[model samples]
Target: MPTGVAIRDVREQLFDAAERVLLRDGRNALTSRAVTTEAGCAKGVLHRHFADFDAFLTDFVLDRIGRIDARTGALRGSAGTGTVADNLTAALTALFESAAVAIVGLITARDELRARLRRDLPAGVPVLTEAAELVAAYLVEERDLGRITADADVDTLAAMLIGTAHLLFADRFGTPPEAEGVRRIVTTVLVGVGPRP
Candidate 1:
């Protein structure tokens, strides 16, 4: 590999490469060499940016979690406008469509990564936990706008949605579950919460 080629935005490049490797090869296949190879940079490039392989993986997981944080604003903005089911369907679809499930798989597969993440996270699985938090935040917005029931347990509901969505998206060889299929799951979970107002 060429040693002198300049790679702009090396951190993002490595993150993207790691995500692709995680999604395509699963976590066990992810390694410093594989990531650097996929990113078209020297393995030393990864080390220079992160302390170690697990550090890279920890930041990689946090980076994806930060992405879920980024989506919260737009999702919250949709609070009262669309049908609750529609809003939720879109949100959950967007969450899983990214390398979320793959990242979750990566975290689960790496004990060291999980330990590093615990310093900041401390509870629940990293990606899925934040996914549920964002969903819960959106549900709170909807409830405030009267789109969801006043009595609805938004936190539990959000947790349930994330769990169910994880199951639906988990283990797919490649093709994601259809949007319609996702919508049905969303609607079913929201059913007992009361009709959308």
Candidate 2:
């Protein structure tokens, strides 16, 4: 909102405020006014940066997806440092802890926003698919290091992990699975994939 401030900085601030509102008060509470008020900016600031509320929402969700993808990508560097199951649990845990789950409902509730995202993003795959690919790549790295079995189906394993993360994060009544629970899920899935003793 301030003069001479970078647009990226302003957008980041708005995004952070929006995420806080969504996480604290749920998806319905996320409004331009709410985000601006939380960000300490003028009510018009959101509209100034985005064409409309739907656009802002689309951007916000996409931003979160980007972050999730980046986190999965970073898992490559940690390939052999920890137990493969532990490393995967850590990645899945990070995805669960993100605002992705909270915003997913918001995106799905509005068809227009969802359509807009599909239009803006590449036609091939959604962000979650890309995330799955990242996980598969990490699994491959582990297999190459002899951490996991060579015959493991990394693609199927990646999809299973992503689905598990979605289920764990989407739980409304119960607390989401913690790191230990995630580790358990990963270990269970890797029963055939992990190296034999």
Best by TM-score: 1
The prediction achieving the highest lDDT against the true structure is 1
Predicted structure 1, TM vs. truth: 0.93
Per-residue alpha-carbon lDDT of candidate 2 for residues 64-171, written as tens digits (9 for 90 to 100) = 888888776668989989778878888888777777677777776778887898887754235566667889999999999998988999999998888877777786
Expressed as tens digits, the lDDT of each residue in 1-197 for candidate 1 is 57888889999999999988888888878999999999989989999899999999898889888886676447777887878888888888888888888888888888888899999994999988887888898898887777778889998999999999999999747578999999999999998775453
TM-score of each: 0.93, 0.86
* After superposition, candidate 1 runs with Cα above 4 Å error: 71-73, 195-197
- Residue pairs in candidate 1 whose N, alpha carbon or C atoms collide under 3 angstroms: none
The models' CA-based lDDT, in order, is 0.86, 0.81
How far off is residue 109 in model 1, in Å?
1.0
Clash totals, every prediction: 0, 0
